[model samples]
Target: MTTLKALKGQHHVSAITANAMKNYEFYTKILGLRLVKKTVNQDDTSVYHLFFADERGNPGTDLTFFEIPRAGHTYYGSNSVSTTSLRVPKDASLEYWKNRFNEFEIEHDEISIVSGRATLAFRDFEGQRLALVSDENNVGVAGGKPWDKSPVALEHAIVGLGPVTLTVQNISALSSVLKDIMGYREKGKYEAEGHEVVVFETGEGGTGAEVHVVARPDLPAERPGRGSVHHVAFRVENQEELIKWANYLKELRIPNSGFVERYYFKSLYFREPNGILFELATDGPGFEGDEPFETLGENLSLPLYFEAQRKEIEAKLKPLDTREGGKN
Candidate 1:
């Protein structure tokens, strides 16, 4: 064991999008999140990798998307990161969002309580399943600051990410990876949508530092496509801690992507036993490292490795206007 520390909380959740323009509009305009990064998917430079987060693109606030134009609709099932949660300032914020969703004709469910928190579940234009979790009762893993210029009021704006829900066919298999390997402790269990949801939390347990797993053996394995989660990344301190984790995974004989540089942060990736992709990512050298805070995501950003190829990459990607004061 490296003996550094347990993983902090969720770093980010990356999903798939068929259209980056629409994804950008919906997340930044309707949902009121800031488009913190406009970059290409490092794995496949032909498409965009969009990051939406709180004002500063803080560690636990990012929700990213990789554009795959030809990707089909997702067939929801087991062995997937099913729902990504965003945190609001308080329980009352749920009512604000519910009304906002209705005004925009955005699909959403009524406010409901889960795991002792008020949550409102909704889908984006492409049916990306997401929920806004209330922080009225939250105690650990503090959320980030919402962008001041967001159309949504500051008091009701989303702060950071909340618990990500994982659906698996073999609960024990995933549980072992989360508990035995990742150091998440079983927080509690609750019944929802006809299944028993087991909650687990890592450092400083709260809404921001938890994962809710539910077994769905009755359903087939998920067919991933647009609107489906690609991976959920947990927080590590920095590159040094990330290196320790790489060594730790190596010592355990677990296959992993060793110490990958993401410009914004260092990363290591691996899949849990249930086949759901999980990542360990660092917290620093944030989004502002390259772009100024005033216009963070206004332009396309590229890592140094791709800067030489910028003209070619820019030609392949469709132009996305993320400048402030766009249509709301």
Candidate 2:
């Protein structure tokens, strides 16, 4: 059975060029997320793997990165997949980001909300689309940390993904898949001209996050390339729940991308009925196992797999100073 006791909701990582330093500044100084891990890609030494998260760089709080220089700007069309929708606390902190965007000259727009919550939309240094949201509950970055000069008594940070959108040529086809096959319920419209935004909060949630899906009927097929979202992960309670999801996908004859070992997590990937890439990940032994909560994101840490080759990899990877992803 694919059921387990708990499932870590997400482990967000970026796919960008080799500008490691700029990312450091934006994530730490500007956005306020602590730099959890500094390491190079195990498979590709020339590239790096940077992790950012809450006080401890926990799985759900994490927004990781991959530096891939040669990758070009992603094309935004109908077929293009929806990547990440980040949630922020939604108060004066939003003003912080707004002014920060102005100060750093980061391009962004305020997202419209009906009866749900307030949201701000922006992109990462890598051009992957991202969102900042404020919802009913104020649960986020560990309290007592100073964000900006203000004593941000709450966690004003990237909590996790709000939702991933999928644009299908045939709306009805995707709709059926989401309903009959996937256990997703329709949330509501988040866009005026685009496809409807569908959502599904975790029935067995460990935190207070909601998944949103904004369908784009007017777009063309998306090509997977650099700076684009690799995939979106969904959370299950445990291994038993994971296998149950696998079996459910099997029942629909969906192809499993295979189980991937993310070190801190184990995940199974497959496209849902609407063609949105879905990952089922376990929650446990989070980022803390690699670094202490006190010193997370301050330095680089590598798994045993890449520890020996740090020197050689460091030479190939370029400094983020060369390519600044953030405006400021």
Candidate 3:
């Protein structure tokens, strides 16, 4: 078996949201993530595509969304990404977030230790599950860049993405895919909120490396809609690694969208055994590719191919209120 080498950590997590403004408020105002890009979905130009991240909009920091008002609520069940966890510095940092959430009236659970790390669970306005995991080991945070202007204190700002949890019908094949093909190793196991969970870690076993699988065979299959995760993307070093990943998938007889140029980064998408969508994306040619860093997210950005239709696309999108200095 060929051992995977290029896979690093999470590249970005993309999900669906019903309202662009609401999603923006939650991630930017509430969570204090930087609004890195304001664009439209490449495949569906009518809906807005938003990207939120830390200072530089680094690979692991990105959490993107597609706005589709009529998409309806998500049906959570087997083969769905259940939660996206953001990493915070240990104990003191978690305390800061707990107080911050309370001050803002954002609902969150009490801190609890899971898989040997303290975690604070919460959900966004649209009911998209999220959590804040305290990583005392520093994990991937040593290299994180914080947005200085964020409402939250610099020391306590969300460092980066932590482990993402997936609910699957069976863990067998998915476990093999993660371990063998994805280069993740089984770390530990624990029960969380009444469900049996298994932990898997990617490169170096830190913040962005964790992937939690929760077996839920009795639940119905998930139906995608608003607030559902569209796909969970893992990071590859660059385009070369992305292409290699695509070829590797084919060698394993796994069906995938080979070598997709996603504008910001190259990507390859494939569905795991339990139907959860996974993507391997490159790290370069980021948010600043279209707009200057200082003016990022100020105006709608379109790919080169869509430049000719910019006027039509902008006319269709609902006007966004980008005023700063207050919570929604």
Candidate 4:
């Protein structure tokens, strides 16, 4: 029985999007995050899977989207990842974003202290729930480096992911999976809109690696579609450790997708007791493995298994011009 190292902080959050073109423009031009990977969803190659992140697409910085052109609206409710947080440099960054959001006519809330940090809640073009959290007091997991070329100034740019908010009806069950099985510890609690949000942290324990769970027993289970989160992945050291975790899940009779090779990084996918999809993924053999660092997201990238059908795949996907900056 090899003891696995504790899961590192948050890796990435995969969400659904109805329009990849607009998503690309909004994330890159407005948010100032780099388009790190331009690829198709492995499960369904007909659709695009875009990755946005800090300069290097570091493990903790990735925010991905799976384009489903005909996907329906997301009915807000329980048993879902309600809001995804992005980390900015410091507290003052919120002020810059507040004005930027106004200039772009992006719907947002006023800056306020939530879960002991300054946060600004905002929605994207399709109403994807998001928040910008300041790393002014973050001491645990360090944030990533923002791209110098981002339209947003370097001082106000988003660095990496912050705490993800999960809304569930059964908090006890989800808490057991996060604690007993995954080894996260409850840090504290805060109140928001008449609901209590319980904060949990793992690895080094900071904004970069926290999950804020709020019990919403009053609402129905979410009807997921575009603008909804697909899944939240936690960081693992490597494929070896990922395999160990797969075995551990099997030993405990927790059903999981055993050892999946995702090309860039290996993964193990499973559902928590509350039905939110969760993934454990390796941190290396990253985005740069298949594409060069200088021009990572300029073209459509595919795994070796799918390379043979590149022409067919390209035929199905609508053209998306990602070579906006010329070259990194």
When 2 and 3 are scored with TM-score, the better candidate is 3
Clashing pairs in 1: none
- The alpha-carbon RMSD values of the candidates against the true structure, listed in the order shown, are 1.0, 4.7, 1.9, 1.3
- The local lDDT score (0 to 100) that residue 100 gets in candidate 1 is 95
lDDT of 4 by residue, 105-222 (tens): 9999999999889999999998899999999988999889987878898988998999999999999999999998999999999999998999999999999889999999999999
* Candidate 1: segments with Cα more than 4 A from true spot: 325-327
lDDT of 3 by residue, 183-294 (tens): 8889889998798899988776777888999988999999888878999999888887777787788888899999988898888999998988999988887878888877
Work out the TM-score per prediction: 0.98, 0.77, 0.95, 0.98
Stretches off by above 4 angstroms in model 2 are 1-18, 42-45, 137-158, 171-182, 204-209, 224-226, 239-252, 273-276, 306-315, 319-328
Checking candidate 3 for backbone clashes, the offending pairs are none
List the candidates ranked by lDDT, beginning with the highest: 4, 1, 3, 2
User: What's the true lDDT of residue 137 in model 3?
Assistant: 67
The per-residue C-alpha lDDT of model 2 at residue 104 equals: 73
**Model 2 per-residue lDDT at 249:** 66
Question: Could you tell me how far off, in angstroms, the CA of residue 117 lies in candidate 4 after the best superposition?
Answer: 0.5
lDDT of each: 0.92, 0.56, 0.84, 0.93
**Highest-lDDT candidate:** 4
On TM-score, who's better, 1 or 3?
Answer: 1
lDDT, model 1, position 20: 85
